[model samples]
Target: MVGGIAQDDARENRLIDLFNLHQAADRVRHGTDAILKLDNVEYEFELKSATTNKGGISTVRDLGPGHIAKWRGKHWIMAFFEGSKLLYCRYGSPDAMRPWITEKWDYIKADFEMAKYVPAHITLDTMFEIVGKKEVYTKADARKIHKNQMSAAQYETAQDTVEGYSPARMLDIFKDRARYVIERGSTLNNPHIPSKYFESWPEIRTNHAAKLRELVSTWRDAKP
Candidate 1:
């Protein structure tokens, strides 16, 4: 019975160690807000909704849950917590709590760093000057931008795909096609684009290039 109990304890310790390692990795990747230590935590405040004015400035009111408000030199900053750290993303205005709604969380979390406290958490209707209009890029514009950004081979693959070339002929072609639409620009509304490319496009587009490469490698290896 004692030996069995010892084994159980060892197993429990191993699990705990694994959990800690996982948490450490998460902290490294996602950052932390350390809510308990308000003084040490820098918080961002955002409104639950937006209202626009004649100048095309948008104002946000009401704080989203877990969003903290803090005052800087001349402006009110609102932000949300990811784990224990303030979420890092680009804000459109001085008073905006959340980053632009369109930004991917994975991209935002890449900016996490060591925890430090700035004043956070204020529950009130605060007025902020909206910075400017959010730039609206059409699907075509996005594609053109992507074309400009692609390598010579990637650009060739994209042009070929648009012209109804099947990327299935080669793994490099397939991968390049995927990067053209998914990474360089969105693939929305292009009927000629392959169904297979779209199947994993959403996932591949959001991930880093290394991840996309791994996915492409797996798909290539599976191909007969």
Candidate 2:
């Protein structure tokens, strides 16, 4: 949701080109990266990148509450990766995803009250529950990942911008987190996820391999 073309821009841009989708002109916080015209309807998708090695946690860590609020009801297209190798991409609407995750907002508000703002995120364990962790990471058919390394100029602008900021203080800023939970998906709940949602998916939840086969069944016909 960052406005500028950051390190992940390379990956986002490539996806737009590869899919024959138009790139959004003005990239901003809580904004989309690509556009599509299907059946005379305009569709805007918020693209996200997750490293397979990192438990599908987003490469971009700036998904705050407001950003997420703006993201609701929009289509999500996430590309998985291992190092610089791009894996499969997945698409789903909010309705299709609602059952899989639970949102926690109370602790998020408390954190802000204490002068610390935690980022918000959707629970992805449901994705793992529907498919499996291995299915998302292990299979790379042919395509390699597109790397989007940030330019030096943006780094310079962001560096030590805080007043009276010392190198040590800057290091601390990177290390610090709120006393309350910062991970919205990881908060404690009466009924835990993956477990609660597990019983619902009888077809592929237990047989994770079926999830991969299922993707092939509905595979889209296109060229890279």
- Whole-model lDDT per candidate: 0.27, 0.44
Cα lDDT tens digits, model 1, 1-224, are 69744643343233223222112234321133111112243222221111111122222232121112231211121122233332321121222212322232233232221011111221111101111111332234334334455565654554434443332222233233334343323211211212221222223222222442343345335647
After superposition, the stretches of candidate 1 with alpha carbons farther than 4 Å from their true spots are 1-38, 44-170, 183-224
TM-scores, each model vs. reference: 0.18, 0.43
How many clashes does each candidate structure show, in the order listed?
Answer: 15, 1
Decoy 1 TM-score against native: 0.18
Which TM-score value belongs to model 2? 0.43
lDDT (tens digit, per residue) of candidate 2 on 38-59? 6465656666665655434332
Candidate 1 lDDT score relative to the true structure = 0.27
- Predict model 2's lDDT versus the native: 0.44
- Which candidate number maximizes TM-score? 2
